[model samples]
Target chain A: MRPLPPTQRPNWRYIAAEMVPRWCPASARDMHYAILGCEASLFGDSNAASMRTSVISCDGGVVIVRCIRGTEDDVETALATVTDVGVAPVALHPFVTSGTIHGLKKKIVIRSLPSDEGNYKIGDNTYRILRMSGQKVDLVQQGIKQTTALYLNTDDLEDF
Target chain B: MRQFPADTNYSFLPQGRFVMKTADACIYPYPVGDASLRRLADELELRGFTGAIAVGIPAGCTVGNVRFLSGVDITANSVKSCRDALRSAPKTDVVMVHAGDAVFNRAILGNIPLHILRGIYHTDKRAFDHVSARMAADRGVAVDIDLSRIISESGSRRQRTLERYREISRLSRKYGFMLTISSGGRSLVGLRSVRAFVLLGAVAGLDELQVCEALAAPAALMSPHLSVEVIE
Candidate 1:
């Protein structure tokens, strides 16, 4: 074997310090020094564990968080505060017949899953999907003209 | 139609030893092969509830070994249909009808052998009124007060519901008709204790005593032999 150079020599003293006997009762001074060494290693040190950024996607106002291998409850709790404004968690009830979607002149069957730009049903007969900024849908019902809209939670929609 | 238990006593017990003899007026029956009924029975037993009137029980389905004695709920859109249906139905301990149209409500009030009148404030137009209240008082038809509507709704709709409930309460007092408060809940989470119902009655402008009376009304209606004695 070739002899090592002086610059490549191992720190014997440092290695010896780390090899303290487990059976030996640790003295207060020894414990203090050990803690100081640990502090040096842990605080303001580049060798410490690095934190990875969580994968998050926000399209328009719809925030989709990707939690790899996370439980449903954990993900739900993490996104508890972040919700899409004006968009409710309602059931998407498609019309029974495709003709039902196309037949109405006053009522438009939501053709595609509404993007941020699409109109949404707010009541039994009213909608606010035409313009994204408005709160009411002006339409004629039965024979009476009405302006008030009833907003329903997405969870309450039933498929008919 | 199973015969009602002849030995069943409907007397109100003293407080702390109170057994919930009052049946929940309206409960949709569990679907065939569903364990919700069994779970509901277990939950009722745990909650010290005696029995409930199972509404909308599917045809040919048998409800056996439940903790509570069960009754059937019959719903119809018109008075003639309701009458025809009731006449055809097999004899049960209690027969509760869902109040539909104004005509149906009026027709069933005094003429029919109905145990309970449910869904008084379900529609935009009130089905129950002062005239209906008078008929209910005369015929001994107990008005069912379902708490599920109050618990499930909010905002202006909830306000409307509360107003309707208040109106019912007012009419109940003026006409001296029997009133029974029910959870009207489909699940175990919806079932509330008699004490809790009384507290809710307070919110609906009914005194605690009136609430207890309401609870006892069903039992009294079921077994005429049992006399209600209010302690307070």
Candidate 2:
């Protein structure tokens, strides 16, 4: 079989998305499936299949998604629909879209890991601080079935 | 690529305040979820929002540069109950009612105190019709298109939501009723960026300009009470 010429090949666009919470451990494969699932649900099977979306790479809390050039808008819209991967609730927000992977990479804001801020108590339950970046803090309250994620800020912490 | 830094204080500066024209009309902060109003304001700033209406929080305060307006949501099952709820609803910047049946919607749209009609996605298919749409337009009551349901729901549920939103979008185009966009976020992670809302709005058949106008509608809703001053 012979490879097609560059002009004959399908043009692709890359999108850079950052997973919320900064602690979601979903890998590139997980992100790929999540995007596919969201696209399928939002655009239906035929439209989603025609989009030809895939995960190019995952670094830290960011994932680079590649899709057929003209379908960038559809892909970005689908990415907004993805609320979770596996059982962990998360949000994948696309920050930039570009024709070249190099250009997309340059536009990706470098994500940093959330550091331990401190512990806080509200009423009867006690929560442990999971991730703190700037004014926002992510707290985890252990429940019977799953952990409850509490998103708060420094001012709220001070009130406690 | 326009993501703001985590600590970016969108407008809460002592020297100068950058008031954002765009605001999320509705979000439930703390008690509903662990995210406090201040945290939600900060998250909105990081996501490019300059102001928001917190359902349970006190109105008229600026947190981290993002203007915070108080709002009250009435979850009633009937028109009479909705009217009663409105009568008792605490004084806030915005008052919204969850959509019910067609009769309920028509009755509530004409209410002078109602500022917004929300939660149309889960209502009956005929809940909001041409009559209600016309009434809303005439009354200047905005219809809220919540993106949180579109973002969180899937399968048949998501399809139904999109269908409802499409119907509302079509009606708004024809009737020229005001439309408001909200995340209906319960936590910080649930908040979305303006671009995200615009893209999600497209999924519901809203154009870019429509989405931008919807985002800015909340600010306009609050300006009607401003005192007039002579510019001369």
Candidate 3:
């Protein structure tokens, strides 16, 4: 391969950030994850506790989240609230389909996936990820769709 | 681990370890673009995932053509560059590389490490497509690809999906790659799926933690993480 011309030499900063860490955090990295989005929030239901609907500007998209963990009611009602409501009536989430077995009691079987993308921190040492899961079920009327739910796996929202 | 009782909400893994097949992470190229990556990450987060999606693209192509979905914190957009980086890294450091490509006119199989392949997926689409296709054509590389979890989440007819998998499996196996049963939750994988292929059982479905009695003693013989005491 030929050497890059001075003009064509690409910036190392983009590549450095892309491949490996070039900068260290001011403090030790603590692994923590956030619960984002709910079916309820998708439909413009705003009063879902401490969770707020916001978007990260670096990458643009609106998400349902809590700047800090909220109340249990906040978590309960708001978790997985951003579901697709207009389309169907009784579809189960994907986790349910993936792990749970349905019966009279709506029983589910969930296996912990070793790594959840929701759980990560660049310069931190902690390991946390939102407990995102899915279950599959067919509605007698509407059809099949994935129902999603979220939870705080860390102490940040454990009280909630 | 114990067998999961049907009604229990928390199911036990076949053994209590995450299955380590890199293929378990193989994803189709369409969803890895900028905006989509972030949404995908959020969706994965809401669903409780920690690993990065192995976004495969065709190789030797411009970076922009690959539509990178935005949700991920750090995308590994360089399978091509990792090799150059690795040649100069420390001896113990892992370099990203795929197993096999370039055989006779007929495609063959090669041993690209799973983690390396996973990293490459984040690069450009053409690079990924070329890599997978070349593996199919030259080295018989098989892509156990899938639509993004979002697409899987998006509603679709079961029959249509089943047909799609069947076709994809046929294509992969035709050129010398095996197709694994993924996407659908808890599928009924039977002896029937492995009919004519030159492959074996689903690597993803196996109990990852289960080991033969023989290799067990040796790892225990080693120090640190690999070391485990034998129990009667």
Candidate 4:
């Protein structure tokens, strides 16, 4: 493959930008392609060439990779063999957006019940607005002796 | 000497300090924010942990290069409830049971499917015995040895923990059941580096290769597709 021009040589940031658009909505198989593409672009052809035989695919978000003479064992070794190019697996979200509710520290209601210990509750009362972090929320409910923290997705909390 | 912490936030980990370590992954067993999984994956890649696994990930969350495995911790004593939880855990890649009464441990080991019994440890009572180890080995259940318990406790508790590990190690050798050593930390500070985990394993009477094998046990449990080559 021809190398990009000096001005256009894809850096990590550039590769990441290319990946962000397809990341969230892409299927697990597509996500594997994104990861491979980013790694190949940022780390250059040599590293990518070595990983050529390690075919990475996914089933239900679980990664399944195989080397040339692949078996279950080869997959593990292949995974360990990959050089850590310091590539972040997921895209970083910008703190600001064009919306009324900001990201973290914003108050949101517990639209859904939490599945873990992070949920805060009072006597017979489960619905309340809690302060949000990235995935965690500071829950302080009346009648509950101690405050608790909860995770967002599992809790199914909605923004108020 | 890779260590899988039972719970941790990759976002809170000290980038510089953690990145330099030899450990490749830290299993976060809690629900990480949808956006944070990606961000943390990016941060981990930047820090040289090209392979990090996050458990208990919620649905609709997109995973990048990082491995995302779902799991749930079963603390219930009722055999029916535990079995029900295991049966319903189709999305979970691993199932960790908090070992309590010996009867409950036997019930879990004998009846649960081999793939589903990923981890069984965490108890003051002597939950694992000769019979339990044999059952686990036959069924492919891994016995988890959480280093955080040894680090946090003191005096008699620490000694008991060490003794329990030694016994488990012996059983592991005799029966050939998989042993997984984890930090089981809730925070970055609680998480130990690979060197520390190896040393802790040594103190628990496990040799270096055994410790390494213990570290790799989780990888096998996470996916049926992963299997480490046996070195002669």
| Cα TM-score of candidate 4 | 0.47
Runs of candidate 4 with Cα error greater than 4 angstroms are A1-160, B1-26, B29-53, B59-66, B87-90, B114-126, B222-232
lDDT of candidate 3 over B125-167, digit per residue (tens): 2333333544543432233323222122323332243344444
- The predicted structure with the larger lDDT, 1 or 3, is 1
Indicate which candidate wins on TM-score. 2
Which has the greatest lDDT?
A: 2
Per-residue CA lDDT of model 4 for B23-107, tens digit only, reads 2223553333322344444333333333433455543132333344445556667778878877776555567776766787788
DockQ of 4: 0.02
lDDT of 1 by residue, A1-160 (tens): 9999966853221000111011122343443333233222322123211211122222222222222222222222112211111221111111111112122212332222222334444345534432111121111122243222222112112211
Please give the interface root mean square deviation for model 2, in Å: 2.1
Ranked candidates (TM-score, high to low): 2, 1, 4, 3
Error of 3 at B75 (Å): 8.2
Report the TM-score of chain B alone for all candidates: 0.75, 0.88, 0.27, 0.71
- Better model by lDDT: candidate 2 vs candidate 3: 2
**Per-residue lDDT of A10 in model 4:** 24
Computed on C-alphas against the true complex, the DockQ of each candidate is 0.01, 0.66, 0.02, 0.02
- Per residue, candidate 3 scores C-alpha lDDT tens digits across A48-114 of 3334422211101111122322232333222222222232111112111111112211422234432
Once fitted onto the true fold, the runs of candidate 1 whose alpha carbons sit more than 4 angstroms away are: A1-160, B1-22, B32-35, B56-67, B124-126, B224-232
State the DockQ, from 0 to 1, for candidate 1: 0.01
> Which candidate leads the pack in DockQ?
2
Q: Could you give candidate 2's per-residue lDDT for residues A1-160 as a string of tens digits?
A: 9999999988998888887867876888988998899999888999999999999987678889999988988898888888778777788778888889989878876757777656778788788886556666777776776667888766666767
CA lDDT of each prediction against the hidden true structure:
0.47, 0.82, 0.24, 0.46
